[model samples]
Target: MSKLIIPLAIGAALLGAPAIPLPSGAGGGALQARELPAYLQCVPYAREVSGVRIFGDAHTWWSQASSRYERGNRPRVGAVMAFRPHRKMKLGHVAAVSKVIDSRTVLLDHANWSPINGRRGQIERDVKAIDVSPGNDWSEVRVWYAPLQALGKTRWPVHGFIYGDGAPAARPRVVSPPTHVAVTRAPSRQFASAFDAIRGGASPAGYRQAKPLPPQRGYRQAKPLVPQQQESQRKSQGQRTGAQARDPIAQVLARYD
Candidate 1:
């Protein structure tokens, strides 16, 4: 069983939002209130995608004395958690949540979450969120290299799963394929090359100009030709010659005889 950390001071520091009072007589062994700011900052993204509003301290398990795992056991949709080693820096870590899409698999979000200059605030993304876990919360979550920046922008499909008893078993139906309707798509190698060329500012005169088109006529009269001219042209034709050579009267006489 993973040990849970429930720090009390962090719960006291929450400003506008009222703290969630833990259930009385709820097996109070140890409680470590989680920090509000970092967890609260992730709430908007969670709410937008998962439809659940996270309030109060984010609950996590202490896998070891120095290390804490934010998401474990009771995995819920849109819940974000951190994974820190037992005796390491605060920011060199991974963050993700349980995506309840189905009964079989779940999605994860993690990135190059190393601390910049030993500060808790500095973090960046070499981040990807594409891990799948079985339908049990206790099962270890597998991290995927695929990261999702926007909810619907990948060629691959997005899905999630739930674990444990009485959990819903239906898979999330895909409403539509991921679309790119943004003014500019995410930067690619071609865009980078074009940007580099423009920055170099080497203008050549090899550019071509467009050509002009001819004016159009509103209407035109059909040309009239003699019927004899058309007949004369077909006079030497093989099909017409073969048809003319067949004797219709001889065929009728042969049939009668």
Candidate 2:
């Protein structure tokens, strides 16, 4: 009766558990996991092509470049155009400027932007991007969509352009040496005694110059502590002792002794 109750509880728990959707090609129980196709994201692709080293989400690149890279609203070749997060684009997007057509239009090279052949993460090069802002400040833009074969209707907001030209290299961190290192009690006592001797105009006769340490070298065969003759004699004595212990006649003699 108790065993039946345990089985029933397990069955109820499993039935209530939610079903999780696995990615395509991730086969059933016994099959080994397969590698998914490479998906190139905008951030890494822009950094690789434009030479911008800024990290984190695409939207954050504008603020992060304030100290490291130069930024402006006007687009130029090799500059990354940062987009502000709008309705569906919660993380925003970035693209490298491939060519500057004029003040209002430019060519872009980016990835994972538009769905091509019904698949996302497709790379698009030299696609059109136009400044549609009322003041022509490049604050809003319309980018090319592969499916539509024209500029997308949505006016994606722009944070501006992050220029990689002459971007300052990250300064190496400078860790200042510790000002107050603790002195052990034994060393302090020794120093105090030496100071007292010097103050009293008395020479410290007990003090001697420390010997220099041995020079460091790569591994070498170590010299035996005892002389060769002594080591050989010790080995001979050990062998005789081991032989006697193993002999039954010697064992009986040893017990009597």
Give the Å shift of residue 75 in candidate 1: 9.2
What does candidate 1's lDDT look like per residue over 21-135, in tens digits? 3555444634423334443233233333433333322222122211222323443454443333322333223244445443323455433332345433332332323322233
lDDT, each prediction = 0.38, 0.77
lDDT of 1: 0.38
Q: For each candidate, give its TM-score against the true structure.
A: 0.23, 0.51
Model 2: lDDT equals 0.77
Candidate 2 clash pair list = none
168-234 per-residue lDDT for model 2 (tens digits): 2222233567999796655577678888887897755587656887757886756656788788989
Where does model 2 exceed 4 Å of error? Answer: 1-38, 167-257
- Weakest ten-residue segment in model 2 by summed lDDT: 248-257
Model 2 RMSD in Å is 28.4
Q: Cα RMSD to native, each candidate? A: 27.7, 28.4
The Cα RMSD of model 1 versus the native structure comes to 27.7
Instruction: Give me the candidate number with maximum TM-score.
Output: 2
